[model samples]
Target: MRQLPKLSFWQIWNISFGFLGVQFGFALQNANASRILSNLGADLHHLPLFWLAAPIMGLIVQPIVGHVSDRTWNRLGRRLPYILGGALVSMLAMFMMPNASMVVAWMAPVLFGAIIFALMDGSFNVTFQPFRALVADMLPDEQRNVGYSIQSFLINAGAVIGSILPYVLTNMMGVSNEAPDGQVPQSVIWSFYIGGAILIISVLVTVFKTKEYPPAEFNEYKNISEAEQQEKQSFWVTLRSMPKTMVQLAVVQFFAWFALYLMWVYTTPAVAQHFWHTPVGDAGSAQYNEAGNWVGIIFGAYSLFAALFSIAMPWLAKQWGRKTVYALALLAGCLGFVSMYFLTNPNHLIVSMIGIGIAWAAILSMPFAILSSALPAKKMGIYMGIFNFTIAGPQIISGLLGGTILKTFFDGQAIYILIVAGVSMLLGAIAVYFVDDIHAKSH
Candidate 1:
């Protein structure tokens, strides 16, 4: 195999920068969607149902985007076209989401909000899966960890900004965190707007600055056989031929994403009820809004710690094996999530966030790094797209059963859902031990 040249740190950073925008948008969605929906009249039990929009979008969108982008080469380059297109759509979605009430006067704001949520996440999925393939396409095997680590850093950095923006606007700039009946607060409205603008600008930097190898050069560098390069197989057919590592990774992904789904769909309610002493289904209350803002700060802490951890993770992985580091990071997150069940002080949550942040870093980078070495050169994009099922699948299952489980087992307490999340993450940590990393020791 012709070795791909090592990229400078800045070169890798620039290539991964577009993800900063995607994760920024994602952070906004994760931190605020429950709040926004509740403000618009949805029950807490239905929040997970609403969140099904994102993963469903990812499940359908990523593989198609991936399959098409694998064959898509143009002036903008293979992944750039999708990256740019998705960003533009995402910008529009961000603008539309918080303003879902105003758009369709005849429809319920909650329903419109769900639709917009789908669009926002669908657009993110468009950019996200390709970004994964892009790293595998560009970086040599030895540099793959760096590429993904840098990508993880950018992702968490963007998340930190996005998650905190509403709180910043409310507290620092004196924007109103309250709104009229059935309307989202001004701080949230403004965060989406700013996030949209930054999304497009950051994506433009990547589209304009980074270049992709043309098809001919990429094939030569990866040493793909001509017949394999030209070969077309149905996704299901290719699924049967999947690498053992990908299958193993999927098992771990299921639990990791299941845990994350609980956090995203329930954290606002859990924190509001537990720390802020808000009533169930309390929307548009001062206490609830305060809880929402604090959740933003807390989620920002999660991403900030994730960003900080990303810098240290590669070194840790190199010292221990990647799988070992991944397991330990998830263990930290399990402790963090389980602790949330017992903590009532808002500020003390930051201590718990540190562990989740470390796990988030490993979750973002380690699996992809492990999988990249096992994937076929000719099908990086499609396989990366398919790997997303591991992400979206568990979340889908969680969303479907989440409400029922909560009511049945936990007396509908959101805090107890976090305990379930902890258990799931613990399972993921254990599953990490079984993954067959092709470069298990080296990375």
Candidate 2:
């Protein structure tokens, strides 16, 4: 079998640059979606259900995009076509999401926001799944760690900007942070608009600057026998034949994503209530909007730390082993979540983000690095798509439970939700210990 050629640093950068755009759009959604939903008149109890659009659409879109991208070969290359198409759709969705209330006065604002959220998420999955596969495809085993780390770095880099955009706009550029009831802030609206433009432009750079190996070259490099090449693996067949490592890693992914889902869904309300003393129904209050923008800055802190930590994760993985590093990182994240309950000063939450950022960097790079080694080269895209199930499934389950948990158990206290997230992350840390790191084993 001929090994894949090692790509130069710039080549790797070019291929992974699109992640900046993808994450730029995604981070905006993550940091702002809850605020938007609340602004559109969503109640605190039902917020999780409304935020369901992202993970639900991801559940449906990622695997299909992966399967199709695996078989596709066009002038735009296998993954690039999907990347470009998804970027355009995502750009439109980002632009429209913040404006959902404005477009249809008669439509329920929550419903409109949900539809737009799904569109943004589905488009993101289309680009995201293939991009993961592309890294595995283009890089040899020795370099896959670095490739994934670079992707993580760019992902968090974009996230930093995306997360901070609204805060920066309002604070520095003097954009209005407050709007009338049922409308999102002008700062957030402009942030989305700028984010959309950057998303498309960054993706186009990757589409033009990076080239994919043709099918014949790819088959030859992986040493696929003609018969094996010709045999099409049904989705069920692939599902049944998944590597044991992938199955084990899925367990780790589940709790990790579940914890993250809670944070994303409740952070805005939690911060508003905890720091700003805004009541549950005060979405239109100036204090509430200010709290939301502060959440953006807090998220930016984590993203910035994640980007910096990504630079060190690969080396740490090499020294301590992937599973060890991952588990420890998750443990830190668990503590980070727990720290939230004690934080009286909102800005002090940046300390909590340091631990969370370490985990974020590890989460973005480690599983993919390990899983890529165990996957069949020909089936990389599909398996990566299926791997997303672990991510989306946990999120879906968490969203379903979030409202019930808030109403029944917490007395509508969002701070308690952070404690639950901390415990969930602790479970994830334990789960990671069970994953067999094929890369570490092989080395």
Candidate 3:
């Protein structure tokens, strides 16, 4: 039997706290960047391309990080080194992103911003892969669910604060909301600085305070035969021969992420154009900041519901099984997306988001758990990295297609993009029914 050292609840909390900071960066990006692009004179049709850097970077970085980290086991620990390094780089990107329009012209600003954002986004994933593995390393399988749940809670908690920061700063701090056309507001700039600082500090807290299990413990369950581990195939060969299950999950992931990309890309515009009844780029417009605040409220509703639903999921899983629970969540999300077509009032958006949030929680936790159970312990890092390719790859595909859909089918009506996305998610939910969860358990 492999003996694992016990981690107390607080110790687990301390180790995972950095994710709160990371989510702060992600929340700000997801909730507001498209709106910021519009403020900075980006064409509505071109906005999806501006978000492309993140997915492209993720595709390249995650695998390399996993490959390298698998071969490393240093004194400060293999994962912690990447965690600290990535956080510092991401902090720099966070500080520079809001200032991009200040320095350059037209798409130049966004081009430069995307470059930095891509770097930071990729680095963050580097740290993220190993960190989850670290939990599996330190905790017994029974405690695994609790460890991941804490991480999920922190992710949502951080999102709430990050989502609300722009509203808080604009309303309470008297920060200047106005900027030269094609520039981010002063309040948003300050939010990035604060977020960057928190990013570094939160990760550092974990690095200084938490100790990793040694290599012996990490490899105790990793005693596969050398012949089994030997590679007759190259990277391209393995890539070509990717497991059928992985390919199936990728299809499901593609639709799931595409829908989410649509939501993140167009929520503000959907609110501003459809619900708030306002045109873009009008300052004294009641819809301008109101749209921004409602974005926060909508995001807060989804994230808060995600947090709540994550807690309820274990119970649901017990009663109906994970696939059934996931199917119900996706069905709810489809209904929520369909409802957006009818949403005239801003308050109703929150109700729609509650449905989406249930799906979001399942998206974050369940797929990975299912995938992790199937992968070999030695290749967990690589397989997880490959799993992330599904995420980034779909986002890239969505970025390309979402823009086209918004421009052509929707007639620049971003809400219809969500309708398409909702249908996509429904397809993803249906695909989950075919996955072999029985094999996952036997493994």
- Ordered by lDDT, highest first, the candidates read 1, 2, 3
Which has the better TM-score: candidate 2, or candidate 3? 2
Q: For each candidate, how many residue pairs have backbone atoms clashing (under 3 Å)?
A: 0, 0, 0
Worst 10 residues of 1 by lDDT: 275-284
Each prediction's TM-score against the native?
0.99, 0.98, 0.92
Q: Cα RMSDs of all predictions?
A: 0.9, 1.0, 2.6
- For model 2 the local lDDT of residue 277 reads 88
- Per-residue C-alpha lDDT of model 1 across residues 1-443, encoded as one tens digit per residue: 67788888888888989899889999999999999999888988888899999899999999999899989889989998999999999999999999888965699888999989999999999989888999999899999888999999999999999999999999999999999878999999999999999999999998887989998888889998788877889989987998999999999999999999999999988898888877777777899999999999999999999999999887888888899999999999999999987776889999999989999999999999999999988888999999999999999999999999888887777899999999999999999988988787666
**Candidate 1 residue-wise lDDT at 28:** 96
**Winner of 2 and 3 under lDDT:** 2
Off by over 4 Å in 1: none
> For candidate 3, lDDT tens digit of each residue in 1-443?
46555679898888788888888888888877776666766777887888887788888878777767766788888678888888888888888888888667445776666666677677677667777666655665555555676777777777877887877888999887667766788877887888888888888888888787666666665554556555444557657765666777777787788888888888888778787777643433446757876797689778888888877775666667667877778878888788888877788888898889888887876676566555666666666677788899989989998878777776777778878978988998998887766443322
Q: Given candidate 3, what's the lDDT at residue 69?
A: 70
TM-score winner between candidates 1 and 3: 1
In the predicted model 2, the residue pairs found to clash are none
Score each candidate by Cα lDDT.
0.92, 0.91, 0.75
lDDT for 101 (candidate 2): 82
Where does the lowest 10-residue lDDT sum fall in candidate 3? 280-289
Error of 3 at 172 (Å): 2.7
Any runs in candidate 3 off by more than 4 Å, and if so which? Answer: 3-6, 105-107, 225-233, 240-244, 280-286, 439-443
